[model samples]
Target: MGLQHTAFMEEEVRRGLDPKLARRFLALVWAQRGLVTLSVVLLFLFRLCAVATPYITKLAVDRYMNRPDLPVGDRLSGIQWLAVLTLAVLTVKIFTHYFETVVTQVVGQRIMHDLRLRVFNHLQTLSLSYFSRNPVGRLMTRVTSDIQALNEMFSSGIVALLGDLFMLGGVIAVMFSLDWRLTLATFAIVPLLLGASQVFRTLQRQVHRVSRAKIARLNAYLSENLAGMKIVQLFRREAENRRRFEGYGLDLYRTHMKANLYASVFFPFVDVMRAAGVALVVWYGGGRVVQEHISLGTLIVFISYIDLFFSPLRELAEKYNVLLSAMAAAEKIFGVLDEKAEVLDPERPEPLPDIRGGVEFRSVTFAYEPGLDVLHDISFTVRPGEMIALVGATGSGKTSIINLLCRFWDVRLGQVLVDGTDVRRVTQRDLRRRIAIVLQDVFLFTGTVADNIAMGNREKPRASIEGAARAVHADAFIRALPGAYDAHVSERGSTFSAGQRQLVSFARAMAADPRIIILDEATSNIDTETELLIQDAMRTLLAGRTSIVIAHRLSTIKRADRILVLHHGRLVEQGTHAELLAAKGMYARLHELQFEDEAGARGIVQAGEPSDRA
Candidate 1:
């Protein structure tokens, strides 16, 4: 996501699973305690049925088969009854397994749903700075793959571990009851098994940690590359990009191979241990049975119990990998949940009802980074219904001023007031609702033209949408499109021309009926014809509303009520367009330079017309 997020992830991998993180994760699951408890109960029932199967077979052999003193009919009857009981046990085991799988999976999915929504909601509350530092793809991984990992743990890893432990416990108890000597023989191999498992876990955890990081980086790279594919093609970077992608893919491949290598050696070692345990049972228990110390049935049961015991051990080793992966995912998810929003509403916010659109910035000094101010002691005021234009060189804090007024970033020093009430004193939602911003780069979601104009405010009636469109001169072109206003908009309004998108953006701002309008380089991308249309529409659109327009083009803001020229984050000049020009200050110089550039551009075009005729 960011350097900080990446560092934290690496630290978590090095530190391994934190019990505190696991507890926090469990707390989320505990919110659905009813379903979780039911799933656990079903698991236990399944285990009980599974354990009974071997014992029923033992009972048939020990009680019925060895009783030769009984009549044939009685013996046959007993055998038949025991067979039916075994079938019944098998039936119950199958049903219990079915129900348990269904319940556990449902719980897993419900938890995923809740967690996904929780993460999404938290994302909404985070400040814009957080998003600036994090990429969309990395954050998406947190919501999608990471949450899926936790779901896998719930469905298979954690639940399976519990079930396996329960099975192992039941098997041990039954084995010891039949013959302590044979049970002790099986116990001898467990220490070796445990040692092997410890080694495997350590190795696998590191692999899993690295593996997760690799996948996340791969996703981020893929996302970034795909988003910029047009540039890549224009630059002919196809070969270079493919090589880089191959490198990422190979890195992931090596990680998986390393994990597989470890598993290959470890699992076979576990099987050898199981075989050794089985061999021990046969050797020691067979002699005991021959000496009449235990029945043949008891010896067979010991062997069956031995298999059951080792089965869990093997399963536990496998589930441990899933557990480690889930732990890492949980840590990352909780990290996001724990991030406090840099901008927050005061516990008791001042009410800002019926805002009258007057804005004031009182000696506002701000910095995106400490000790590096972007805006230095900036002070300005806009009376209601006044249209002021901000003109400056790039990075002279023109857009930063807009950001402060909108409270996108809080001022480090002094107050930004809306209608003389400190903007910070009111909730951001309340303050922002009174302002509408139309930026240079307008972002439109994938939806219909009408939807983009409404911008998720579904309460706007069809008449208002159309009226706003017509007011911004967007209605004419929109009605000419394939489905008219109902035509589909591709991602980021790529389907529309640059001018069309800008017009739609203006319409959107107008549809909001905001008290204050912000047009930051809003007309810079429009052609001359479209610009004239917008300028004509803006006279009517901006009437009786406080508007702040920031543009690089001098001609666009020539008629502003007043012009403020900024130079290196300071207010160098402010006055009516003619007044600034008469004073011969920074505004005059900028205006002259732009006029010369336009003349030079016209000369070049006129010069090229003769070559075309030739």
Candidate 2:
């Protein structure tokens, strides 16, 4: 073997028997049982060819070289036949080996692909709370790096380990039948081989666990920093961010080196044990040949058998280390899949009619984490086609109200009704389809402008897309682009300005054509000129649909049919904008503060100004 050969492994990974995870993993393997069975069978056939070759060599040597009792011509012809048979067996073995690789590789790739999709689909089912607690970098590792480890497990690790066991069995059975005493002598080093293997496996596991943890940590830090790089640069904290990143990078490098150290030590240790086993067979078998107790052919075959048996044992250990990484990866993947969706749809969902846009919150109280209430005893209602505005101090649960209405989070104490139906009773899909939201921080995926506008709804025609853009007054800017509606948008619409992104978002919501519109600070980023265009669209858009607008600007707030002021998560005031303003309460003070902060026009504070003030 090459001195430079090293096993590819991660940190100090501990192999666990997470019983529930094991069963789920086994079920996945069982799904492809037919292909798996055939691959194993081919591996077994290859082992048979390997074991038979040595025995044929023994026969050729004895009959042609040592047995002068037969004619020389006959012995020479027999030797030629043996050589031809040897060539044929090796040819079959090589072909079967190639086919096995093909089958197993395909199986491995297919399994990983399904696992990735399964994880992503399950993620979609989970509530926003799950994502809030977990970071994107950590989840990305589960889908990419972790899945790659499992691919190795399926393609070559576990299957190769099985083949090694079969090969070992064949070698042991054949050797014992050929000569019992020499087999016993060869078995003398078996205990040492087992002992060394155990020690190496323990070391490998420790190294692997360490490596995997560091890699996952590094990924988390990288993803977070990348996303917030703009803020980091804006604050002039580049040095601090770089220092933190360097610490994570250093930790990963240390753990990786430790894993590599163990791997290098393990393969060489196996090689030494292999050498010991071969030496024992040679010493005993040579004595037998000298005494004429066993044929020279038999002695030679025993030596060959020693190589076959020990080689598999060595391979089994290496592949077992790879399997440890797979087991760890499986634990993480299954952990995500097992998490229950905190917000669930009814088993037998109530039928939801086309929404007339009436929304009511009847004594609704909510909290993200238990005992930390963000909203308390909140009750309000919007009649069909009514435009209501929500105004409050920061942390007064204004956003929480929107979350509950959208069913992103269910209210703890009361019913959030769309039309006459409690949101919990209405299926989530049906409920969401009837409402549209345009958020302040727009999230646009990478695609053409038209595709982003239409979002995922595939039934929309180009004309409909254009109409939505025009209604949002976004058609002019979109048409000015190089490819107009077909122009490519970069990540999160970074290619466009803030106003342009908001307009694109408005177009998206309009295309959905929902009965209720939630504009949560949607125009906070628009310039005065663009704000005028949007204000024009707002009048037309909110005409026949119920709308919930969360705004701080006095102008936008005053336009609402009614205003509800939340103070410390409690509804402190509710009535028409003039009525609340005249009452001289929380609404009056909030309106005064807003007027003091901004000049006229749409009355929105510019983007990047204080978004929330308590």
For model 2, the local distance difference test gives 0.81
Could you tell me which 10 consecutive residues in candidate 1 have the lowest summed lDDT? 604-613
Listed in order, each prediction's TM-score against the native is 0.93, 0.93
RMSD of each candidate relative to the true structure: 5.0, 4.6
Give a tens-digit lDDT track for model 1, residues 108-132: 9999999999999999999877887
What's the CA error at residue 314 for candidate 1, in Å?
1.3
The best candidate by lDDT is 1
Q: What is candidate 2's lDDT per residue for 1-614, written digit by digit as tens?
A: 11122121123344553566667776877888888898899888888899999999999988787899999899999999999999999999999999988888878888888999999999989998888777788789889998898888877787887888888888889888988999988888778778878887777776666666666767877788788878989999889878866876776677678777876887787778778877877787888889988899998888788789878887787787777777888877777888898999999999998879999999998988899888889888999999888877667777888899999988889899988899999889999999888877888999899999899667899999999999979999999999999999999888898888888888998888989999865565557798888777767667788999886556667788998888788999999878986899887776676654674654563212213221
Q: Supply the global lDDT for candidate 1.
A: 0.82
Model 2 weakest 10-residue run by lDDT: 1-10
lDDT on C-alpha atoms for all candidate structures = 0.82, 0.81
User: TM-score of predicted model 2?
Assistant: 0.93
